[model samples]
Target: MNSPELQNVPLFAFATAMEFSKVFPEDSSKAESQNQLIPLSGPFQGCFACILGVGILDFSAGLASLLFNCKQTNFKISAVISLGICGAYPDRGLSLLDVVNVSSDRVGDLGCEEQDGSHTLWDKSILGGNCCQAPAVIQKMLVALPQVVGATVNCCTGTATTAVERVKNMGCDVESMEGAACFAICQKFNIPAFQIRAVSNIASTRDKSQWKIEEALEKLHKCICG
Candidate 1:
C-alpha cells in the first residue's frame, strides 16, 4: 500500500497502539525479516497511523481532526483502514483471535429509552443509514476473509442481555466501540473507510478469562503485514 502520493495514500487508523502493537517493528518478529513490508510504526513509505482514541466521542472528534487538521499540517488522507480488536457474538462462528472484515457497522446504542423497558434505537432511521462499506480495492484484497456485520456500542457488550439487544436491533455479528464512528466520518468526507478487526472476546459472555487480546493482536498483525 506504499506510494509516493502521501496525500492520497490510505491511512491505517487505530483506536490505540496497543491493539496494533504487533505491527511495531520491535514487537513483530516477522517485521525483522521482511524489509519490503509496509512499515506501519509511524509515517513511513506512504503509510501512516491516526489514533482515533478509545471511545465514540473521542473517535468522532479525532477523526474529524484527522481530516480538517491535516489542512493546516499539510497532510491528507485519501482512504482509511481502521483496525482493532472486537467482540464477536458467540454463535457467529467467531472465536478469539479470529480476524474478519467488517462489511457494515451501525451504532447500536444511540436512541431513546421508553418507560416500558422497551428501547427505540435510531440506527435504522439515522439520516445517513447504516451499512458501511470499504473501498473496492480493500474488498478485493480481503475477499478470502469472512465479511461480517458489526455493532458499535458505547461499550463492550458485557452481558448476554445487552448482546441480545444489539443482535436483535442492529443484527450485527460483532461489536466494537469505534467502528461506526470511523465509517461515519469517512462517509462524510467521501473517502473510502474500512474496518478489519480480530475477535478478542465473545460479546455474549462477560467472563474476562475468555478474552485473548494478545493472541488477537498477533493474528491481526499477520493479516495486515503478512
Candidate 2:
C-alpha cells in the first residue's frame, strides 16, 4: 500500500520503545541497538519508519542517525512524519482521542524571563520567530486530518493560568515536548514534514485519570496507517 513517492519515508515517533512497538507491531525485530536510530517497517504501507524516543535529546540523536542512514543507503527521504500524543488547551474543544495534524510549530519557552514572575513572549520581530510550517504537499496529502497549531516546550503547562497565557501568546491548539524541534530540523534540511498527534490530556491538569493514552495511541495508529 505504499505510495510510490513514500517508499522510503521516515516516520518518527517520540513514545517509549514499548509504546512504539505496540503501535507498530510489524516492526517486531530487535532494532539493532548499535545506534541511535531504530530501523522499522510499516505494516500497513511497508514504508520505512523509526521510533526516535521522546523529548529533545533522543530526537537530536535520532535525526543525526537518520541522516547518516539516508546517505549510506543512497536514499532520498521523501517525507519526515512525526506521530505521538500531546496535551491540549481545553478551550480548543479537543477531546482525548482526537488526532491533529500540526499546521505549524513554535518553541513555547524560548524567550527572556522577567523579574516580577511575569513572562513576556519572545519578540517575533527581533528574533523573527523560530517556527516551522508543514509543507504544502503534506497539507494536501492529509487534508482530511484535523489540523492544529502545535507549541513545543520542555515543560508542560501545569496550570489553567499558564495554559491560557500560552494560548494567548502563541495561538497554539496543542502542546508537546518534541513537535517544534522536529519541524525545525525538517525545515533546516528543506524537507517536507508532517507532525500528527493525538490529544491525551488537557494541559491545565496533571491528573492521570483525565488522560487517555491508550485511546490516543489507537487513534494515532489508525490515522497514520490510513
Q: Pick the candidate with the highest TM-score.
A: 1
RMSD of each: 5.6, 5.0
Clash number for each model:
0, 0
Error of 1 at 124 (Å): 3.5
- lDDT score for residue 190 of model 1: 72
TM-score of each: 0.82, 0.80
Could you tell me which residue pairs clash in candidate 1? none
Question: On residues 1-226, what C-alpha lDDT tens digit does candidate 1 reach at each position?
Answer: 2234555666667777566456444533432221122344432454656565787888888878767665456555667787889999867777788888887888888889889877788875112222234344345556767888988889677788888877887768888888888888887877777788988888985998878988888888777766
lDDT of 2 by residue, 104-209 (tens): 8877887877897666766231111122433333344467777788888878989888898889888888998877777666666656667778888999857888
Indicate the worst ten consecutive residues by lDDT in candidate 1.
30-39
